[model samples]
Target: MELAKIHRLDISKYNLTFLPRKEEMFAEMLEKVDADDAVLEALKSVFPLPERNTDVLLHGDYWPGNILWSDGKIVSIIDWEDAWIGDPLADLANGRLEILFQLGKDAMIYFTEQYKSVMTKVDYSNLPYWDLWAALRLSKFTEWELDENILKTMKERINWFISQAID
Candidate 1:
Protein backbone atom coordinates (compact mmCIF):
# COMPACT_ATOMS: atom_id res chain seq x y z
CA MET A 1 0.00 0.00 0.00
CA GLU A 2 1.20 3.53 -0.73
CA LEU A 3 2.38 5.31 2.41
CA ALA A 4 3.66 8.75 3.20
CA LYS A 5 6.48 9.81 0.94
CA ILE A 6 9.59 10.68 2.94
CA HIS A 7 12.98 12.12 2.06
CA ARG A 8 15.48 9.63 0.77
CA LEU A 9 17.99 8.64 3.42
CA ASP A 10 21.50 7.55 2.56
CA ILE A 11 21.26 3.81 1.89
CA SER A 12 24.74 3.22 3.31
CA LYS A 13 23.11 3.46 6.71
CA TYR A 14 21.38 0.15 5.99
CA ASN A 15 24.34 -1.73 4.63
CA LEU A 16 25.84 -4.69 6.49
CA THR A 17 28.73 -2.57 7.71
CA PHE A 18 26.43 0.09 9.15
CA LEU A 19 27.01 -1.48 12.56
CA PRO A 20 30.45 -2.66 13.59
CA ARG A 21 29.17 -5.85 15.18
CA LYS A 22 26.98 -6.75 12.22
CA GLU A 23 29.86 -6.17 9.86
CA GLU A 24 32.06 -8.46 11.95
CA MET A 25 29.40 -11.17 12.00
CA PHE A 26 28.83 -10.90 8.25
CA ALA A 27 32.57 -11.01 7.63
CA GLU A 28 32.85 -14.19 9.68
CA MET A 29 30.07 -15.79 7.66
CA LEU A 30 31.71 -14.76 4.42
CA GLU A 31 34.87 -16.52 5.54
CA LYS A 32 32.94 -19.68 6.37
CA VAL A 33 31.40 -19.59 2.90
CA ASP A 34 34.84 -19.26 1.31
CA ALA A 35 33.83 -15.96 -0.30
CA ASP A 36 36.79 -14.16 -1.85
CA ASP A 37 37.62 -10.50 -1.72
CA ALA A 38 35.83 -9.94 -5.01
CA VAL A 39 32.59 -11.31 -3.63
CA LEU A 40 32.95 -9.20 -0.52
CA GLU A 41 33.61 -6.13 -2.62
CA ALA A 42 30.63 -6.89 -4.86
CA LEU A 43 28.35 -7.07 -1.87
CA LYS A 44 29.54 -3.64 -0.80
CA SER A 45 28.65 -2.27 -4.20
CA VAL A 46 24.90 -2.33 -3.53
CA PHE A 47 25.00 1.31 -2.55
CA PRO A 48 24.05 4.04 -5.02
CA LEU A 49 21.19 1.87 -6.15
CA PRO A 50 20.04 2.48 -9.69
CA GLU A 51 17.86 5.57 -9.77
CA ARG A 52 14.18 4.73 -9.41
CA ASN A 53 10.93 6.17 -8.11
CA THR A 54 9.52 3.02 -6.51
CA ASP A 55 9.71 3.90 -2.86
CA VAL A 56 6.88 2.52 -0.73
CA LEU A 57 6.01 1.70 2.86
CA LEU A 58 7.93 -1.52 3.45
CA HIS A 59 7.05 -4.07 6.08
CA GLY A 60 10.85 -4.39 6.34
CA ASP A 61 10.54 -7.85 8.00
CA TYR A 62 7.88 -9.59 5.95
CA TRP A 63 8.56 -13.14 7.08
CA PRO A 64 5.85 -15.74 7.65
CA GLY A 65 5.79 -15.22 11.41
CA ASN A 66 4.69 -11.64 11.03
CA ILE A 67 1.85 -12.59 8.67
CA LEU A 68 -1.30 -13.56 10.47
CA TRP A 69 -3.48 -16.10 8.69
CA SER A 70 -7.07 -17.03 9.30
CA ASP A 71 -8.42 -20.29 7.90
CA GLY A 72 -5.45 -20.57 5.58
CA LYS A 73 -5.87 -16.98 4.36
CA ILE A 74 -3.79 -14.00 5.31
CA VAL A 75 -5.92 -11.75 7.49
CA SER A 76 -3.38 -9.29 8.74
CA ILE A 77 0.32 -8.69 9.09
CA ILE A 78 2.03 -7.82 12.36
CA ASP A 79 5.40 -6.41 13.36
CA TRP A 80 6.45 -2.93 12.35
CA GLU A 81 9.77 -2.48 14.08
CA ASP A 82 11.68 -2.48 10.78
CA ALA A 83 9.14 -0.61 8.68
CA TRP A 84 10.70 2.12 6.58
CA ILE A 85 10.53 4.00 3.33
CA GLY A 86 12.81 2.25 0.88
CA ASP A 87 12.95 0.24 -2.31
CA PRO A 88 10.05 -2.24 -2.43
CA LEU A 89 12.43 -4.90 -3.71
CA ALA A 90 14.03 -5.05 -0.29
CA ASP A 91 10.80 -6.32 1.20
CA LEU A 92 10.26 -8.69 -1.70
CA ALA A 93 13.77 -10.06 -1.37
CA ASN A 94 13.44 -10.52 2.37
CA GLY A 95 10.09 -12.25 2.00
CA ARG A 96 11.42 -14.49 -0.74
CA LEU A 97 14.35 -15.63 1.37
CA GLU A 98 12.19 -16.17 4.42
CA ILE A 99 9.73 -18.22 2.40
CA LEU A 100 12.53 -20.29 0.94
CA PHE A 101 14.08 -20.86 4.35
CA GLN A 102 10.84 -21.53 6.19
CA LEU A 103 8.85 -23.21 3.50
CA GLY A 104 10.72 -24.56 0.48
CA LYS A 105 12.09 -23.52 -2.88
CA ASP A 106 8.87 -24.45 -4.64
CA ALA A 107 6.88 -22.40 -2.18
CA MET A 108 9.19 -19.50 -2.73
CA ILE A 109 8.63 -19.66 -6.47
CA TYR A 110 4.88 -19.78 -5.99
CA PHE A 111 4.96 -16.91 -3.55
CA THR A 112 7.01 -14.84 -5.96
CA GLU A 113 4.71 -15.57 -8.81
CA GLN A 114 1.69 -14.65 -6.76
CA TYR A 115 3.34 -11.44 -5.70
CA LYS A 116 4.22 -10.56 -9.27
CA SER A 117 0.62 -10.95 -10.36
CA VAL A 118 -0.47 -8.07 -8.16
CA MET A 119 2.61 -5.87 -8.08
CA THR A 120 3.25 -5.19 -11.76
CA LYS A 121 6.16 -2.75 -11.53
CA VAL A 122 8.61 -5.03 -9.76
CA ASP A 123 12.11 -4.66 -11.14
CA TYR A 124 13.38 -8.22 -11.43
CA SER A 125 16.92 -7.26 -12.40
CA ASN A 126 17.71 -5.61 -9.08
CA LEU A 127 16.09 -8.33 -6.97
CA PRO A 128 19.29 -10.33 -6.65
CA TYR A 129 21.09 -7.32 -5.23
CA TRP A 130 18.41 -6.84 -2.63
CA ASP A 131 18.40 -10.57 -1.92
CA LEU A 132 22.12 -10.48 -1.19
CA TRP A 133 21.61 -7.56 1.13
CA ALA A 134 18.81 -9.39 2.95
CA ALA A 135 21.00 -12.44 3.41
CA LEU A 136 23.76 -10.31 4.86
CA ARG A 137 21.28 -8.70 7.22
CA LEU A 138 20.12 -12.14 8.33
CA SER A 139 23.71 -13.14 8.95
CA LYS A 140 23.80 -10.60 11.77
CA PHE A 141 21.54 -12.65 14.02
CA THR A 142 23.40 -13.92 17.08
CA GLU A 143 20.83 -14.29 19.83
CA TRP A 144 18.85 -16.82 17.83
CA GLU A 145 21.37 -19.34 16.63
CA LEU A 146 20.49 -21.15 13.43
CA ASP A 147 20.76 -24.90 13.03
CA GLU A 148 23.25 -26.53 10.68
CA ASN A 149 20.61 -27.14 8.03
CA ILE A 150 19.31 -23.59 8.20
CA LEU A 151 22.83 -22.23 8.11
CA LYS A 152 23.64 -24.32 5.09
CA THR A 153 20.48 -23.17 3.36
CA MET A 154 21.30 -19.57 4.14
CA LYS A 155 24.77 -19.97 2.69
CA GLU A 156 23.40 -21.57 -0.43
CA ARG A 157 20.82 -18.81 -0.79
CA ILE A 158 23.50 -16.18 -0.38
CA ASN A 159 25.67 -17.86 -2.99
CA TRP A 160 22.75 -18.05 -5.40
CA PHE A 161 22.02 -14.37 -4.94
CA ILE A 162 25.66 -13.49 -5.42
CA SER A 163 25.77 -15.48 -8.61
CA GLN A 164 22.65 -13.71 -9.82
CA ALA A 165 24.22 -10.36 -9.04
CA ILE A 166 27.38 -11.29 -10.90
CA ASP A 167 25.51 -12.38 -13.97
Candidate 2:
Protein backbone atom coordinates (compact mmCIF):
# COMPACT_ATOMS: atom_id res chain seq x y z
CA MET A 1 0.00 0.00 0.00
CA GLU A 2 2.74 2.40 0.91
CA LEU A 3 4.65 1.63 -2.26
CA ALA A 4 1.52 2.07 -4.38
CA LYS A 5 0.87 5.37 -2.61
CA ILE A 6 4.40 6.48 -3.35
CA HIS A 7 3.83 5.76 -7.00
CA ARG A 8 0.56 7.69 -6.91
CA LEU A 9 2.22 10.86 -5.62
CA ASP A 10 2.21 13.77 -8.08
CA ILE A 11 5.96 14.16 -8.47
CA SER A 12 5.58 15.71 -11.93
CA LYS A 13 6.06 19.16 -10.45
CA TYR A 14 9.66 18.33 -9.41
CA ASN A 15 12.44 18.40 -11.94
CA LEU A 16 13.93 15.07 -10.99
CA THR A 17 15.83 13.01 -13.52
CA PHE A 18 16.88 9.37 -13.45
CA LEU A 19 19.70 7.66 -15.24
CA PRO A 20 19.05 5.77 -18.44
CA ARG A 21 16.57 2.95 -18.05
CA LYS A 22 18.02 -0.28 -16.59
CA GLU A 23 17.80 -2.35 -19.76
CA GLU A 24 21.36 -1.37 -20.63
CA MET A 25 22.54 -2.50 -17.23
CA PHE A 26 20.53 -5.68 -17.67
CA ALA A 27 22.20 -6.28 -21.01
CA GLU A 28 25.64 -5.81 -19.49
CA MET A 29 24.87 -8.20 -16.63
CA LEU A 30 23.24 -10.81 -18.88
CA GLU A 31 26.44 -11.24 -20.89
CA LYS A 32 28.26 -12.64 -17.84
CA VAL A 33 25.66 -15.12 -16.63
CA ASP A 34 26.21 -18.05 -19.09
CA ALA A 35 22.47 -18.59 -18.96
CA ASP A 36 20.63 -21.08 -21.17
CA ASP A 37 20.35 -19.92 -24.77
CA ALA A 38 16.55 -19.75 -24.63
CA VAL A 39 16.55 -17.79 -21.38
CA LEU A 40 19.02 -15.30 -22.77
CA GLU A 41 16.95 -14.92 -25.91
CA ALA A 42 13.77 -14.31 -23.94
CA LEU A 43 15.50 -11.60 -21.92
CA LYS A 44 16.89 -9.98 -25.05
CA SER A 45 13.49 -9.75 -26.66
CA VAL A 46 12.08 -7.32 -24.09
CA PHE A 47 14.86 -4.82 -24.06
CA PRO A 48 14.85 -1.28 -25.56
CA LEU A 49 11.16 -1.19 -24.69
CA PRO A 50 9.18 1.20 -26.86
CA GLU A 51 9.26 4.70 -25.42
CA ARG A 52 6.20 5.48 -23.28
CA ASN A 53 5.19 7.33 -20.18
CA THR A 54 7.41 6.47 -17.19
CA ASP A 55 5.65 8.59 -14.64
CA VAL A 56 5.87 6.55 -11.45
CA LEU A 57 8.60 6.80 -8.84
CA LEU A 58 10.01 3.32 -8.36
CA HIS A 59 11.29 2.13 -5.01
CA GLY A 60 14.06 0.45 -6.97
CA ASP A 61 14.95 -1.91 -4.12
CA TYR A 62 11.61 -3.04 -2.73
CA TRP A 63 12.31 -6.09 -0.59
CA PRO A 64 11.81 -7.44 2.92
CA GLY A 65 14.75 -5.97 4.77
CA ASN A 66 14.03 -2.41 3.69
CA ILE A 67 10.55 -2.51 5.24
CA LEU A 68 10.64 -1.53 8.89
CA TRP A 69 7.99 -2.29 11.48
CA SER A 70 7.21 -1.20 15.02
CA ASP A 71 4.96 -3.36 17.19
CA GLY A 72 3.03 -4.75 14.22
CA LYS A 73 2.36 -2.11 11.60
CA ILE A 74 5.04 -0.88 9.24
CA VAL A 75 6.51 2.37 10.52
CA SER A 76 8.93 3.14 7.75
CA ILE A 77 10.35 1.99 4.46
CA ILE A 78 14.03 2.86 4.52
CA ASP A 79 16.66 2.63 1.79
CA TRP A 80 15.82 5.27 -0.77
CA GLU A 81 19.27 5.38 -2.37
CA ASP A 82 18.23 3.05 -5.17
CA ALA A 83 14.98 4.87 -5.91
CA TRP A 84 14.37 5.76 -9.53
CA ILE A 85 11.82 7.43 -11.77
CA GLY A 86 10.69 4.67 -14.06
CA ASP A 87 8.20 1.87 -14.61
CA PRO A 88 6.36 0.93 -11.43
CA LEU A 89 6.75 -2.71 -12.44
CA ALA A 90 10.40 -2.61 -11.37
CA ASP A 91 9.38 -2.31 -7.76
CA LEU A 92 6.53 -4.84 -8.06
CA ALA A 93 8.69 -7.44 -9.76
CA ASN A 94 11.51 -7.10 -7.25
CA GLY A 95 9.09 -7.26 -4.36
CA ARG A 96 7.47 -10.38 -5.81
CA LEU A 97 10.82 -12.13 -6.20
CA GLU A 98 11.84 -11.30 -2.64
CA ILE A 99 8.57 -12.65 -1.30
CA LEU A 100 8.96 -15.82 -3.34
CA PHE A 101 12.42 -16.40 -1.92
CA GLN A 102 11.82 -15.36 1.66
CA LEU A 103 8.29 -16.59 2.24
CA GLY A 104 6.97 -18.71 -0.68
CA LYS A 105 5.18 -18.57 -4.00
CA ASP A 106 1.79 -18.25 -2.32
CA ALA A 107 2.95 -15.25 -0.37
CA MET A 108 4.42 -13.72 -3.50
CA ILE A 109 1.07 -14.14 -5.27
CA TYR A 110 -0.77 -12.58 -2.36
CA PHE A 111 1.59 -9.66 -2.28
CA THR A 112 1.17 -9.12 -6.01
CA GLU A 113 -2.58 -9.15 -5.53
CA GLN A 114 -2.38 -6.65 -2.67
CA TYR A 115 -0.25 -4.34 -4.73
CA LYS A 116 -2.51 -4.58 -7.76
CA SER A 117 -5.55 -3.99 -5.61
CA VAL A 118 -4.17 -0.51 -5.03
CA MET A 119 -2.47 0.12 -8.39
CA THR A 120 -5.69 -0.55 -10.30
CA LYS A 121 -4.59 0.96 -13.58
CA VAL A 122 -1.16 -0.64 -13.95
CA ASP A 123 -0.29 -2.18 -17.29
CA TYR A 124 1.34 -5.55 -16.56
CA SER A 125 2.68 -6.21 -20.06
CA ASN A 126 6.29 -5.86 -18.93
CA LEU A 127 5.88 -7.84 -15.74
CA PRO A 128 7.73 -10.84 -17.14
CA TYR A 129 10.54 -8.63 -18.38
CA TRP A 130 10.87 -6.99 -15.00
CA ASP A 131 10.58 -10.32 -13.16
CA LEU A 132 13.44 -11.75 -15.15
CA TRP A 133 15.31 -8.49 -14.64
CA ALA A 134 14.80 -8.87 -10.90
CA ALA A 135 15.80 -12.54 -10.95
CA LEU A 136 19.01 -11.59 -12.73
CA ARG A 137 19.59 -8.61 -10.46
CA LEU A 138 19.34 -10.85 -7.41
CA SER A 139 21.46 -13.69 -8.80
CA LYS A 140 23.99 -12.77 -6.13
CA PHE A 141 22.13 -15.29 -4.01
CA THR A 142 24.21 -17.84 -5.89
CA GLU A 143 27.22 -16.57 -3.93
CA TRP A 144 29.14 -18.50 -1.24
CA GLU A 145 28.00 -16.55 1.80
CA LEU A 146 25.23 -19.00 2.70
CA ASP A 147 25.76 -22.61 3.84
CA GLU A 148 25.71 -25.32 1.17
CA ASN A 149 22.24 -26.63 2.04
CA ILE A 150 20.73 -23.18 1.98
CA LEU A 151 22.59 -22.35 -1.22
CA LYS A 152 21.31 -25.50 -2.88
CA THR A 153 17.73 -24.71 -1.97
CA MET A 154 18.04 -21.11 -3.07
CA LYS A 155 19.63 -22.06 -6.38
CA GLU A 156 16.78 -24.44 -7.15
CA ARG A 157 14.27 -21.77 -6.17
CA ILE A 158 16.04 -19.26 -8.39
CA ASN A 159 15.88 -21.61 -11.34
CA TRP A 160 12.20 -22.25 -10.70
CA PHE A 161 11.59 -18.55 -10.39
CA ILE A 162 13.35 -17.98 -13.70
CA SER A 163 11.18 -20.62 -15.32
CA GLN A 164 8.10 -18.88 -13.98
CA ALA A 165 9.13 -15.69 -15.79
CA ILE A 166 10.22 -17.31 -19.03
CA ASP A 167 7.28 -19.65 -19.36
Candidate 3:
Protein backbone atom coordinates (compact mmCIF):
# COMPACT_ATOMS: atom_id res chain seq x y z
CA MET A 1 0.00 0.00 0.00
CA GLU A 2 0.92 3.68 -0.23
CA LEU A 3 2.52 4.23 3.12
CA ALA A 4 3.70 7.56 1.84
CA LYS A 5 0.20 8.80 1.28
CA ILE A 6 -0.77 7.85 4.80
CA HIS A 7 2.30 9.37 6.40
CA ARG A 8 4.18 11.70 4.09
CA LEU A 9 1.34 12.99 1.93
CA ASP A 10 -1.38 12.85 4.62
CA ILE A 11 -4.02 11.20 2.45
CA SER A 12 -6.19 8.81 4.43
CA LYS A 13 -9.54 9.23 2.68
CA TYR A 14 -8.74 7.12 -0.38
CA ASN A 15 -7.20 4.27 1.59
CA LEU A 16 -8.87 0.86 1.71
CA THR A 17 -8.21 -1.41 4.64
CA PHE A 18 -9.90 -4.81 4.61
CA LEU A 19 -9.75 -6.94 7.69
CA PRO A 20 -12.64 -9.32 7.42
CA ARG A 21 -14.77 -10.49 10.36
CA LYS A 22 -14.53 -14.26 9.88
CA GLU A 23 -12.25 -17.27 10.31
CA GLU A 24 -12.54 -18.39 6.70
CA MET A 25 -9.53 -16.29 5.81
CA PHE A 26 -7.60 -17.61 8.77
CA ALA A 27 -8.75 -21.23 8.81
CA GLU A 28 -5.78 -22.57 6.85
CA MET A 29 -3.36 -20.84 9.16
CA LEU A 30 -5.18 -22.11 12.22
CA GLU A 31 -4.96 -25.60 10.73
CA LYS A 32 -1.21 -25.40 10.21
CA VAL A 33 -0.67 -23.56 13.50
CA ASP A 34 -3.33 -25.48 15.32
CA ALA A 35 -4.23 -22.13 16.82
CA ASP A 36 -6.67 -22.43 19.64
CA ASP A 37 -10.32 -22.24 18.68
CA ALA A 38 -11.06 -19.80 21.44
CA VAL A 39 -8.37 -17.52 20.16
CA LEU A 40 -9.41 -17.81 16.50
CA GLU A 41 -13.04 -17.25 17.40
CA ALA A 42 -12.15 -14.16 19.37
CA LEU A 43 -10.06 -12.96 16.46
CA LYS A 44 -12.92 -13.65 14.09
CA SER A 45 -14.89 -11.14 16.09
CA VAL A 46 -12.08 -8.59 16.34
CA PHE A 47 -10.32 -8.91 12.97
CA PRO A 48 -12.68 -6.53 11.23
CA LEU A 49 -11.90 -3.67 13.60
CA PRO A 50 -10.03 -0.85 11.90
CA GLU A 51 -6.61 0.57 12.70
CA ARG A 52 -5.53 3.35 10.36
CA ASN A 53 -1.85 3.85 9.52
CA THR A 54 -1.49 6.61 7.00
CA ASP A 55 2.24 7.01 6.55
CA VAL A 56 3.66 3.50 6.64
CA LEU A 57 5.11 2.26 3.35
CA LEU A 58 4.12 -1.33 2.62
CA HIS A 59 6.06 -3.53 0.21
CA GLY A 60 2.79 -4.99 -1.11
CA ASP A 61 4.31 -8.49 -0.86
CA TYR A 62 6.73 -8.23 2.02
CA TRP A 63 7.59 -11.92 2.31
CA PRO A 64 11.14 -13.06 3.12
CA GLY A 65 12.21 -14.22 -0.34
CA ASN A 66 10.88 -10.96 -1.74
CA ILE A 67 13.36 -9.06 0.43
CA LEU A 68 16.53 -9.51 -1.56
CA TRP A 69 20.05 -9.49 -0.20
CA SER A 70 23.38 -9.27 -1.99
CA ASP A 71 26.72 -10.38 -0.55
CA GLY A 72 25.23 -10.44 2.97
CA LYS A 73 23.85 -6.91 2.74
CA ILE A 74 20.34 -5.76 1.93
CA VAL A 75 19.64 -4.94 -1.72
CA SER A 76 16.00 -4.62 -2.77
CA ILE A 77 12.59 -6.08 -2.17
CA ILE A 78 10.70 -7.66 -5.08
CA ASP A 79 7.14 -8.65 -6.05
CA TRP A 80 4.54 -5.90 -6.16
CA GLU A 81 1.45 -7.78 -7.34
CA ASP A 82 -0.60 -7.01 -4.26
CA ALA A 83 0.71 -3.50 -3.70
CA TRP A 84 -1.96 -0.93 -3.07
CA ILE A 85 -3.24 1.78 -0.74
CA GLY A 86 -4.11 0.47 2.69
CA ASP A 87 -2.86 -0.30 6.18
CA PRO A 88 0.82 -1.21 6.38
CA LEU A 89 0.06 -3.65 9.17
CA ALA A 90 -1.59 -5.87 6.59
CA ASP A 91 1.67 -6.21 4.76
CA LEU A 92 3.48 -6.81 8.02
CA ALA A 93 1.14 -9.59 8.96
CA ASN A 94 1.32 -11.12 5.48
CA GLY A 95 5.10 -10.85 5.48
CA ARG A 96 5.45 -12.35 8.95
CA LEU A 97 4.13 -15.78 8.00
CA GLU A 98 6.41 -16.05 5.00
CA ILE A 99 9.29 -14.90 7.17
CA LEU A 100 8.52 -17.44 9.85
CA PHE A 101 8.40 -20.35 7.42
CA GLN A 102 10.98 -19.25 4.85
CA LEU A 103 13.47 -17.43 7.05
CA GLY A 104 12.86 -19.18 10.37
CA LYS A 105 10.88 -18.09 13.40
CA ASP A 106 13.72 -16.29 15.18
CA ALA A 107 14.37 -14.07 12.17
CA MET A 108 10.67 -13.39 11.86
CA ILE A 109 10.55 -12.18 15.46
CA TYR A 110 13.62 -10.03 14.93
CA PHE A 111 12.20 -8.44 11.81
CA THR A 112 8.90 -7.83 13.55
CA GLU A 113 10.60 -6.04 16.42
CA GLN A 114 12.68 -4.00 14.00
CA TYR A 115 9.59 -3.01 12.06
CA LYS A 116 7.78 -2.22 15.28
CA SER A 117 10.48 0.27 16.17
CA VAL A 118 9.78 2.21 12.99
CA MET A 119 6.01 2.18 13.23
CA THR A 120 4.54 5.36 14.63
CA LYS A 121 0.80 5.64 14.09
CA VAL A 122 -0.74 2.21 13.49
CA ASP A 123 -1.38 -0.61 15.92
CA TYR A 124 -0.43 -4.04 14.51
CA SER A 125 -3.49 -5.86 15.75
CA ASN A 126 -4.91 -6.53 12.31
CA LEU A 127 -2.02 -8.83 11.45
CA PRO A 128 -4.00 -11.99 12.08
CA TYR A 129 -6.48 -11.06 9.39
CA TRP A 130 -3.66 -10.58 6.93
CA ASP A 131 -1.98 -13.75 8.08
CA LEU A 132 -5.16 -15.70 7.57
CA TRP A 133 -5.69 -14.15 4.18
CA ALA A 134 -2.25 -15.22 3.02
CA ALA A 135 -2.75 -18.71 4.39
CA LEU A 136 -5.95 -19.05 2.41
CA ARG A 137 -4.10 -18.03 -0.71
CA LEU A 138 -1.44 -20.60 0.03
CA SER A 139 -4.12 -23.19 0.47
CA LYS A 140 -5.37 -22.38 -3.00
CA PHE A 141 -1.89 -22.80 -4.34
CA THR A 142 -1.75 -26.15 -2.66
CA GLU A 143 -4.97 -27.06 -4.45
CA TRP A 144 -3.52 -26.07 -7.79
CA GLU A 145 -0.39 -28.05 -7.04
CA LEU A 146 -2.52 -31.04 -6.23
CA ASP A 147 -4.31 -30.77 -9.52
CA GLU A 148 -1.04 -30.66 -11.45
CA ASN A 149 0.13 -33.98 -10.06
CA ILE A 150 -0.85 -37.60 -10.60
CA LEU A 151 -3.33 -39.61 -8.60
CA LYS A 152 -1.15 -40.33 -5.59
CA THR A 153 0.56 -36.98 -5.19
CA MET A 154 -2.63 -35.21 -6.05
CA LYS A 155 -4.42 -37.15 -3.36
CA GLU A 156 -1.68 -36.34 -0.90
CA ARG A 157 -1.70 -32.60 -1.53
CA ILE A 158 -5.46 -32.55 -1.60
CA ASN A 159 -5.53 -34.26 1.76
CA TRP A 160 -2.97 -31.82 3.06
CA PHE A 161 -5.04 -28.87 1.89
CA ILE A 162 -8.15 -30.41 3.39
CA SER A 163 -6.30 -30.93 6.61
CA GLN A 164 -5.17 -27.35 6.23
CA ALA A 165 -8.71 -26.17 5.20
CA ILE A 166 -8.86 -25.15 1.49
CA ASP A 167 -9.51 -28.48 -0.18
lDDT of each: 0.63, 0.78, 0.51
lDDT of 2: 0.78
lDDT of 1 at 81: 70
lDDT of 2 by residue, 1-167 (tens): 78888789887877666544455556676778765566667877766654444657777888888999999898999998877767888789889988887887888899999998988788887788778878877877766598888777777777888888888
Question: In terms of TM-score, which candidate is strongest?
Answer: 2
Model 3 ranges off by over 4 Å: 1-48, 55-57, 144-167
The stretch of ten residues in a row with the least summed lDDT in candidate 2 is: 18-27
Q: Candidate 3, residue 97: CA error in Å?
A: 0.4
Whichever of 1 and 3 has more lDDT, that candidate is 1
Total backbone collisions for each predicted model: 0, 0, 6
Using TM-score as the measure, what is the rank order of every candidate, best first? Answer: 2, 1, 3
What is the lDDT ranking, best to worst? 2, 1, 3
Against the true structure, candidate 2 reaches a TM-score of 0.86
Stretches of model 1 off by over 4 angstroms after superposition: 1-40, 141-143
**Could you tell me the lDDT of residue 82 within candidate 3?**
54
TM-score of 3: 0.55
lDDT of 1 by residue, 14-39 (tens): 54332223234334555565334555
